[model samples]
Target: MTVYYCSASYYDNCDYWSTSNCTPPGTYCHRGACGTCDNSYYQCAWANLSGFPPENSIADTCGSSWLCNDKHAYDIPKFSCGTVLWVQDLCNDNGLNVTIADHGPYVCKCETNCNSVNLMRIIDLTEAAYIYLEGSFSRGHIPVMIQT
Candidate 1:
């Protein structure tokens, strides 16, 4: 299912579209236009698959040898390999267009806060991508907006 996000409120789920008098399900009147949410995902971390053993490498999902070197890279769930996405960081207002190089974080690490595990986006970015969006590596994770 395609995810639709609204800026005026917390992110919501919507699907498909029709012409006249048509709005995404679960939403009121079609707002003419819908944009990505500022906080679609509450957590984003830099992916470092290269640090793992060959058996545990993300490269097995997509044969992108440049995942370690490429600053603009992505690893998101649901999207197919090679799918490109236009992403923007809500914190820094930085935008990036990149291709999906890996598929992961299937398990949300709720060790710290299991109360809101469903809110996690499970997105993983390359170190360069994270830094370009003004994320602090020491912090490990940051809230981000993904432009669909």
Candidate 2:
């Protein structure tokens, strides 16, 4: 996964710059925006629908025909629909086999962690899949490595 770090639109002038979060290794920052300093991927959490109950009821980008049952559906930045992703949740030490069903994280920044690649939630998961790895729906994201 390629992670890009950019300043929140609201933090327009870099006033809220955080050295550790904004300038981690292998990242670039300028004018309150940052991006991948290197092409390598890092281990980080990805956002999930479990945090937002309303999102759990929506259809995936794959199509209206696709069903998000059995915790098998997920979304990533730009993978083609139907691609299989073997996800290993780092924090929970759990693994799940999911498919790319949509496109999102439309923004890399999360509520608690902002402009930080290491804390970024690169992928988006269905509520069920998230619960499978997290054992609960309290967190907005989880750390995972995606195996194609």
Candidate 3:
């Protein structure tokens, strides 16, 4: 039940951002512009899927493979993360800012991207896609203290 806040890229700086109908049960997340080989044990495998759909169909309804994309496991969420903070602290902080259009709850497992407005979709998946956990949740970033 642990979680952490992953770092985010600057607003609208994506090399070439695009959108597609995710239907449901999925979303799109920006791993990188140049499509870096999301940390591998053997070696790097960066691709150049600047404006293409990922692999996991659910993540991106377009099914439109990018000229280049990185590996992934689950459907990358079509999320516009606001000034992300420790989910725990998020509950405590009263002065928190939720003005960023890039921040919000998040949509997943999209099938047609119709209902999920403003939510981006990515559909790139691979065997070594699990590495995404690195961007999952950190220790100090959130508010989950380790047990002594």
Best by lDDT: 2
Error of 3 at 32 (Å): 19
- Which parts of model 2 are misplaced by more than 4 Å? 1-78, 110-117
True-vs-predicted CA distance for residue 63, candidate 1, Å: 29
- Cα lDDT of model 2 by residue, 1-148, tens digit: 4432211111112122323345564233432112211111221122332333324322232333432222212432334445566776666568776654433343433322222234334465554566666787666555556676
Q: lDDT per residue, candidate 1, 1-148, as tens digits?
A: 3331111111122112322454455343422111221122222221222233334433343344333223112333334444455656554567675444443443323121112122233456554555666545555554444554
CA error at residue 126 for candidate 3, angstroms: 31
What TM value does model 3 have?
0.17
Tens-place lDDT digits, model 3, residues 1-148: 3232221211222212232443342334433333322222111111112233354233343333521123231323232212122211222222221111211112232222112222122222211221232233322122111110
Model 1: pairs clashing at backbone N, Cα or C within 3 Å: none
The per-model lDDT (C-alpha) reads 0.37, 0.40, 0.24
Among all windows of 10 consecutive residues in model 1, the one with the lowest summed lDDT is 4-13
Report lDDT (Cα) of residue 87, candidate 3.
18
Off by over 4 Å in 3: 1-4, 11-74, 79-95, 100-148
Query: Local error of candidate 1 at 37, Å?
Result: 27
By TM-score, how accurate is candidate 1? 0.41
Q: For every model shown, what is its TM-score relative to the native structure?
A: 0.41, 0.43, 0.17
Candidate 1 lDDT for residue 45: 28
